[model samples]
Target: MSLLSPALRRSPAAASTSVTAAGGADALPLRFAAVGRSFGTGPRARAVLRDIDLALAPGEVVALLGPSGCGKSTLLRGAAGLDTPTTGRVLIDDTPVRAYDERCAVAFQEPRLLPWRTLRANVALGLPAGTERRTGASRVQELLELVGLADQADLRPREVSGGMAQRTSLARALARRPGVLLLDEPFGALDALTRLKMQDLLLAVHRGSPTTVLLVTHDVDEALQLADRIVVLGRSGEDPAASVSQLVPVPGARPRDRGSVELAALRSRLLESLGVDAHRH
Candidate 1:
């Protein structure tokens, strides 16, 4: 059961739409209209986000980038239905998210696996009850293998390395077959080498499954490596006035070479956006 087998690493072009209901033409996946969120009230009120209009077709990967207090994670949480917006709307296939649903899945900064569950079982947890046990098990195994963790299937999260545990979390997300995948800094805690490897693995998994992915991260390099479009957020005044700056598209192809001129230019541009001197380390 090699993790990176051809079966698990199939071409992205062959991916099927996962969360579409049994209906007409899949309804264009997801849409967000003037999405906004706020907190507090009057003089104490704060706007965490505003004017967020975006649409995600099936198979798209968008990144949210910004400083610490900006609303990247808040926006993602709104989309995931984990947090309610004080204003505006978040929609998946035209339906509003008020609670958990099978159409979307989230992977947080931590793997969040139950310590008592093995890697395989954690993934199987996403399956519907009454799913044929063997079928659910097979799907979990397939996803584990896809994320390069098949051999670690029987291990509990505590027994695995952090990177390996995160891969298990990713497998769990994929097992749900959600059309929309929300990732909040899924690789932010990994070591440099492991982060790079996880980046590649994520790209490969996205390719294989082609879900609509929204990733929130502070790491500009990670955004460049994985996002088709990067949205930057910034704080306007002090506590009560933060907002999203702009959405910039990362125009390129898959397996984008880090050293290529186009990628280097993108990296430089993103660094500039962050007000970091590109020439500085």
Candidate 2:
């Protein structure tokens, strides 16, 4: 559920995600209906995903987890309309997604910033196609402040640390004021301390903005810390394609204790589901 443009916008009254304080413009729901994706044709055909059905409630934060190469990114691409599903469809609220959906914004693992642009200018690139100059500038400034990049707004990509660049990427995505903020391993490259700080910052961002978020992450603890629910994807037995294997709703509340005993138990269970030995790993 990622990437934004000038697409669908919904009323705050319709939003149900309460991970933070609600905002003026709330989130829209996203649904994957019997979706399937395959590559090649005839004898060469290989399915990566089949019958992937998941619904994200308005304003909720859901994290996607799966084994490597289990089509996690592929499914996300389908929702973003960067790639089409071979069957079924992805819908935002009641509308089917079009190419490069404007209702969502994606912050990938890489910052993907243009070296020639200042951080402010990079963020401004996400403004809607028809936005007035003044309004867009204001929005970009607000996002820079939101992501704690206001002081460095004048810097270029080469001038900042990796974490700073990632923050800029987040600010750029939010510049679209997307209904659904899609995060694809956005903190995977950072150091442990930086990653933790970015997680806290994300919560702050959600508290201030109150948009629906669909995050795709490989970290089990990350899923436990931030998500309202964790949806696990995996193949069953010898099945070639992956489908939903578990839908575990996270317990407790936001800003959860990182070392909670309950979370530890859940983490072990999740690791086991992914075929890792809890004690050995």
Residue-wise C-alpha lDDT for candidate 2, range 87-206, written one tens digit per residue: 989988768988999988999999999999999999999887998999888889888988988999999999999999999999888887788788999999999899999999998888
Score candidate 1 by lDDT. 0.76
Following a full C-alpha superposition, what root-mean-square deviation does model 1 have from the true structure? 6.2
User: Between which residue pairs do clashes occur in model 2?
Assistant: 3-104, 3-105, 3-106, 4-104, 5-102
Name the weakest run of 10 consecutive residues (lDDT summed) in model 1. 19-28
The per-prediction tally of clashing pairs is 0, 5
User: Any residue pairs clashing in model 1, and if so which?
Assistant: none
Q: Candidate 2 — which residues are off by over 4 angstroms?
A: 1-23
Models, CA RMSD each: 6.2, 5.3
Query: What TM-score does candidate 1 get on C-alpha atoms?
Result: 0.86
